[model samples]
Target: MRISAVPDAADVDLEKIDLFDPLLYSDGDPHPIWTAMRQRAPLHRQVLPDGRQFWSVTRHGDACRVLSAHREFSSERGSLLHQLGKGDAASGKMLVSADPPRHSELRGPLNRMFSAKAVASAEPRIRRAVLATLPPPGHSGPWDVATSAALLPMAVAASFMAFPEEDWVDLVQWTSMAAAPEDPSFRVSSPAATLAIAHHQLFDYFAKHMRHRRANPGEDVVSYLTTMRAGSEQLTDEEVVYNCYSLLLGANATTPHTVAGTILAMAEHAPHFLRHGDADGTRVPLLIEEGLRWTSPASSFLRHAVQDVTLSGGTVREGDAVVVWVGSANRDEEVFSEPFRFDLTRDAGRHIAFGFGPHYCLGSALARIALRIYFSEFLRRFAGAELAGDPVHLRSNFIAGLVHLPMSLVPRAGT
Candidate 1:
């Protein structure tokens, strides 16, 4: 609840800071804490309230090293901060949680689908989806940018998977619950209960869809996945269903927050918005990258040390959980000059916002295209926009996102 300015690095008590606490991120300003960690304790260790302890990798290089060394740092156990016990449904089935060989097998078939060229091919569809989600021209004032930004990504996901348009809302709801189970709006009986229910719902939905895709194949992601093979192995029904769930969650969850954050950034920093408006097509890509870096929506993912590893003068024993803070890494002063400033022209492509290494986000390409189209259309339609009220950040350490952003849009005069 306190909004005090971040103290000097020396003043910070590394032991006292709880990076896993959801409230640390509730204000949408975890940068200062991360900055202190990166500078003073790049390999800080802390224990969660539940008595689980993990090493937090805050620096860019260290984070990259941990993420890249999949052999030494495994994701097979789980990728979330909260450890899902052996009984947990999504422990190793999802693509993000699989280790190499298996990781390669899961991701190999979908590589081309998310390639730069493939995402470029989806631009027109993404643009149409963006346009469809935008409010009618001449309608403006105190709109919830978060809700508006949230809609198109789900629509795009449905289009990509050949899922029903009517089910987009359901997809959004389930993914939201799964992603931010601690948030009051999305939480059901409890975080675990909410996640279990959401997982069940998503699995059921995908299972039914997978059955249909097998019976009558189409050119969607589901159809391709159903037929995809890995050497002598083929995807199981559970694999297909769980991976579909993974894709849906990955594709739907992060971009909307980035889009909403972009709008907020532009409104707060008018010069940036003006520059974006005046720039050519090449500049748009930079803007999109900047948005991803600035927002860092998919904040942190956990990796388990498969073997003893020395990082930043700290030893992480085998089986120790290592939390790689992508959001922190993106703003590390070592890699990014003036990291706090939102400089669209900066080489933000180097940012690990989509993460690094084997478990890197599969839908990164699609997310970029969706964000580009959304911003392009948004700027063209609205001459200027401003925040109408305080933004509400999602209460989850895993996702740095705005769940609500009230904004007033000023349409282009002629429109």
Candidate 2:
């Protein structure tokens, strides 16, 4: 359903108040605004100059309830505020956009591919990919972590999709543009145009492989999709294509930024934790949880209400869009004491950075695995690091991250 304008909010200042504004993320820290809203207006309203309106959920409990209550809040409508007016075209076809029984049927075959055991078994290759792509252990000049470290996730994802190894670098570039189309680094004619072009290129690329896999089937996810059945029904060729797009997007969106953001946090507050290999593995878990909580890269996701529902004392009418700020929820004062402080020891177990319910990130395990290996190797090489320049943030409301992280690595003593 197309979202209609809220005539009641005609006087609101969209430029200053719109939660979907990219400038809120790119220009400076937006935490204060979120903090204010979380406390004073946990269930807030955001109206765009164009008249599109959405409810902004900022508190942890409210965020969780809204994200998980799929019956009341529909994912098939749209999953991002960028589609506030026009709902998702790939709805009901892609797993991320499907709800209930359909979502379950579609997800069952794919779950094992990223199960914990699967990721554990893939660790050897993941470690090798990390080792191969990482800069020299002792190099101590300014390093662009975003550009250099993106290969590990891309490599891991490409292997699963059966994308060629030689195309890994190109895949990385395409995925990044597709992920953060508004960033000047990726913008072609405009943000919308950039996103469209990137998707066009990606869809055409996946179509070639999908068609090839029809006759020459392989063990990869795309190959499986080309032939796999859901009970008596086969996935339409478009469904296979949409799933491929979703998987490629999942691989590119989270971890690299999480790495860059964690590195930023390390440079800023937790440098003392570096250089130790975490030989026991226990310390790394705390660091990983806290880093994911602090960074919160999958910043916001959209859900349109399917029914009139009351949440956190506010009534959300049917058809109203709700944007849950996972980034803000991670920092909710009630959930994390002094949520702003980067405390590696704090138990960040309640973090809904992965969202909640059926729509939770399928690649959460892979993202964690990527971070675990990357940090272990990073610390063994560098004693500590600090920012050489400000981190360039991605101009996206859905994904929060560093576009470029300029940092000087401190090599292990003597090397």
Candidate 3:
């Protein structure tokens, strides 16, 4: 876990170390590593047990620079440290890993589905889905907001993407594990088994749908994908599968975490809810942004450098891996005022919770719409939602969300 020392050793005399054990960040104590790096050594280089060395970008501005600067540091090498195995990695291109011209080609079609007008049109269906899943009024005792939120978004997102609703939960389980295998809770099986299952499930599912869309086109995103040609080179069956799989994971994992985080934040900041009164749904969207700023779902993305580049006053050599800490950046004091406090009214749109640059999340607009509808309906149905039991956090750093949120749903007056 030894880290290469920073230059001009006299000024910054800091003991260099790996952020933590392989699984530490996933366990929920990123602040100790992030706080130390931000103050003492914002750009620390560390070597891992596997002989892999990476530059840890912990500060706010540095993260943005790495994410936005596509030329120097490339996402082409893939976004995570765990290399894809023979079963999946050998098959096709994952959009998050591609560079420039190729990246644009891969994302072009998918981005159309998230266009403002398209997402806005999906609002009624999304709201109806939310209302359908929510516990009916007068239901007593605690309930898992995470499970509740997680279930609805996956179903709605899958429906929008043309996947059968029956397979929704399993898709979520697979993606959650694939995103953070190091975390014990998310490790359903060995890396190989997880990859194999994901590869088989997603590819087979989309391959069939692609044919169906070609024969009988629908208004959904997958239908649009069928017509796209990536510069006379259309995405192979695997590419379409992986892209759709990524969308499902994105909508399911991140949005639900924000939902649970918003509820927890509201409980803590009861005065805000009191001040807003019955305008909870309107205020919930603001709360969603604030929660995303507070608990960024995709905590970090790993990128490999194509050439030597100096960043954060540190020199990064070619082929070096840089771990950009997204959550740390969202909370950096330089950019945020009282960064830790969950201020419901704070301007959180600028936060890189959904990431930045060309690789920014294409499903972001859709995610916001889902959140607005989720919270809007949630507040409308259950006016005085109170925590009925202790909430548990997910044991994964890559995608943070609640595991179990026990709550009592108090019905709103006249509902």
Candidate 4:
């Protein structure tokens, strides 16, 4: 059942094999080509316009190998397809791009912040935030669910990390620009410009807070990060600043999309709505997992092979960039049963929605907490909720998620 591999040269000549555009990858339709790759050329070679040759790893098992075998495929080269432009210091420090030892060292101390206990403990506050934003009992019309859904994760994350509440809106803006660097229309020209503005704004904001946190370290993750001493290898100011910056963007962008995507999934499969009665409590968690697997916010991750390693009988030479198609892997039939069917009870734990191996999402627990809280409250409030209009997904392929979810909420009778 393998589809033939379209050679890197043939399709690429006419702007066919574009790995750079986030829209192409983020459209959530890589399976057709990916299936072809897995069955025929599991290790297909791709050539960028600039003549950069990369190995496209499409299957579930091979993707896992690339992500896990850090020794073989290094994250140091880059984590996405974006060019590593000169003076891009922040990209290197972010956990997504760093290799082991350094990555492990940076991520180790802050694990507790994203742990289940810590996230669970923030439920009361998260619930309040979600409740505040829910549509009133009888409301039913198009409204932006993405903006409303964002409050839960951002509020919880800011509170946990000691980020200022008044700055939440700006923080969200900064993080969005940083995460979706490929989106030209998000702001002025160049993803670099957007990132530079965001970096300075966030760094200045954090520097002010860092002074206070250093003087009187609290129970928050930022406080812990500021004071941590990892055997004479504590985090530097830049690391601390960028780590918070990265965490804020990562935590904010993904979870809300999960909530929005889950709602869309529910609306699309209205038949499933019958199973949960008017109570969404029963159906929300399952919806979250499927939404994550379906939408796959992180989409594709970029890795560089350290040495010449033969993958799927193709030769990936040293210094070659490898694009790991995660969304494709999520839909691979070999790993997931009936990959297209949105089965609520399916065990999708193995999906690479969050990525694989050492660089797996650090804030997974927190992301889940935010998603669960929003859905739990959403279900409780609006069981009969459905999309009032077609949703708009972000233009960029990187960090794919709904930019606008126009939906109406209605109260259920039983509840």
Candidate 5:
């Protein structure tokens, strides 16, 4: 269902008092707004600039309800605030846009590949990649935390997809463009045009590798996609291409930003890290979970209501869109004591940073492994680190990402 018309000033005026504005996220800290929403209007409705109205589920319980009740809130319609044209190639083909039993069908073949065991097996290689990308011991100066954190995930994803070493930079660029289409550095003409270009480039890149893998299957993910069958049917070319794009985009986007956010959190909240002493492997998992909760890089995901549903705060009509604000939910005071404080001891495992239910992030395990290894290695190399400059956040509301994070790593005194 489309919005009837641009909301009148009266309606817009009501929303203006709250943090429902997407632009608010791009400006600076949205925690105050989110906190107000959680207290005042957990399930708030706001009209977009284009007049489309969506319900924002900010409370933790409400966010979980919206995300987990797939039957009531369908993903097939579209998972973004802006609806895709019916003819758009990725409309329902990407994993995030599919509902069960199609969602289950599509997810089954790839489950083993990203299972706990699989991610664990990849740890050593991920460690090496992290180590290789980190500055050497005596190296010290301004470093881009976002760039540094991005390397291992990109390298691991490229290796998993069997992408050529030389093309890793291209893969990173395309994924960044796709995820941050609103950023001036990545935007080309318009967000739609930028996304379309990025999608096309990724599809073409994967198609070439897929064709090769089809003829000569290897152990990599691309090979698995090319050869795997579901029941009597093979995955359509569209499915293969779009899902490959999904994996590549998913692998590169969230973790890097979270890592950068974690480092910044460490610098800003020095006592949190210092109290635990050096970042040992024992506490890395806790730190990673906290980082994921603190960063929540993949902020909000839109789901269309399949039927009328009543949430804790209000009712949503059928066909209306509801945005599950995972970032806000992660900071819900009701669930997290002293929510804003970045405490490593907090049981943050329940955070929905990876989302929830059917569309929960497929690469979450891999992401956690990458984060754990990267931070462990980071701590070993650098006794301390500090932000050298302000972090520049991505413009898009969907992705809570840092385009640049200038930091200076304090190399171990002896090293």
Candidate 6:
């Protein structure tokens, strides 16, 4: 990989650039900013307008170190930039916000449930769910990529978790509110209102299901976790609800963005992104990896340093918040050759899009299965696809993605 020359520390003013600003993500591109930071200030400290501070890690090596060394850089404080200053209410209880050995205890059963074998067993149901989102054979017109794609992940998650299928569409709305409330399309009155309504609805819905599932338990995620145990400890009602919220939030938030981004890349990026997908069905996995890499839907994760640690960039003091930009790390020119070019022929060797180490995405297998089936069906049904209208990006520093993608798919002859 060739190292591109960027402005030195003397030339680029870092303070003026607010990485936390959702507008910067919605209306502008942050990749150039990340590239500049990667070269000049890989471990630069950023102060919010109110004087609160956190360190931003942009380089790939430093991100890996920070994410893998989970103990030294703990998540128990908070795991997202939005949760800065104020600690997470779900800390220690939620899998994404918990630190080990408790993180392991909470995650072990989920790991088994989300393993490859489990996804394979559920693949047929997942495929059925995915197929419902696309046009039927011999039919192709204008497709609402955003509206249709968002349904696929929720349907898969709800089916697996045994949540009512009737509520899948609303669950998508709740996730949008939770993940990108600032966005005009998703917001309700105010961000606080957005959060309050989403949380209340989600928790209330899950609580009802939890109580019912306890009596009429079956082979589903809620029931499985309700009975899951590590050693003598079992998951509490709160833990079950919070974790289910985490699961649904993740599915609704990340997977659809990935699907849209991959489609956008394929239809709009001209030559570079479409090469691998047009090959054979066997290449769908590789395409999914590239899509995950290119979009990096979950932009950054925040970890509080429990102990003083040294990164490739510099030293992180104890009690300091460490924001690892996984999106930036995925696009680091040092790790990837021509990082901007969306090429699927290249191997998915170094992307930390799903994150790294102990906190690597629990839904990764399920996500891949969803995408694989989605793309497989898409390729078979559509002769080609193209962007049809202006794409709308979600306004968020946390969940980075487009909220709406208008597209048209060309139906294959005889399909």
TM-score of each: 0.94, 0.94, 0.88, 0.88, 0.92, 0.94
Tens-digit lDDT track of model 1 for 1-415: 1122333456666667778778788853567678788877888888756667888898889989999998899887788786623323555666887877877877887898878898788787877887787766776787898987787788888888998888888889999999999988799998989988998899899999999999999989999888988546778898889889888888778888888887787777554464347336676688888888888888888888889999985899998889999888987888889777777678887889888988788888888778777777677677778778888888887888888889888776656
- Which residue pairs show backbone clashes in model 4? 22-397, 23-397
lDDT, candidate 4, 1-415, per-residue tens: 1111222322323225555556664353444666566676778776756666666888888888888888888887667666422213655576766887777777776676677787788878766666666665555566778777766667878878877678888888877776776554355477768767876887888777777888899988788878875436777787777677777877876777777776776766653463344353766667678778876777667778888877765778877778788767877788888776767778777888888889889988777766776666666556566677766666554566777788776665554
Global lDDT of model 6: 0.83
Instruction: Kindly report which residue pairs in candidate 5 clash with one another.
Output: none
**Model 1 ranges with Cα > 4 A deviation:** 1-10, 84-92
- Candidate 5: C-alpha RMSD to true structure equals 5.1
What candidate 2 gets wrong by more than 4 Å, as runs, is 1-16, 275-277
Q: Using lDDT as the measure, which candidate wins? A: 6
**lDDT of candidate 6 over 116-182, digit per residue (tens):** 9988998889988888887787777777787778888888999999878778878888888888878
Better model by lDDT: candidate 1 vs candidate 4: 1
TM-score of 6: 0.94
Stretches off by above 4 angstroms in model 3 are 1-26, 84-92, 182-186, 271-282
Displacement of residue 399 (Cα, Å) in model 2 is 1.0
Off by over 4 Å in 6: 1-12, 270-279
What's the CA error at residue 269 for candidate 2, in Å?
0.6
Residue 355 CA error for candidate 4 (Å)? Answer: 1.8
Give lDDT per model, in order. Answer: 0.80, 0.81, 0.70, 0.70, 0.77, 0.83
Q: Candidate 3 at 353: error in angstroms?
A: 0.4
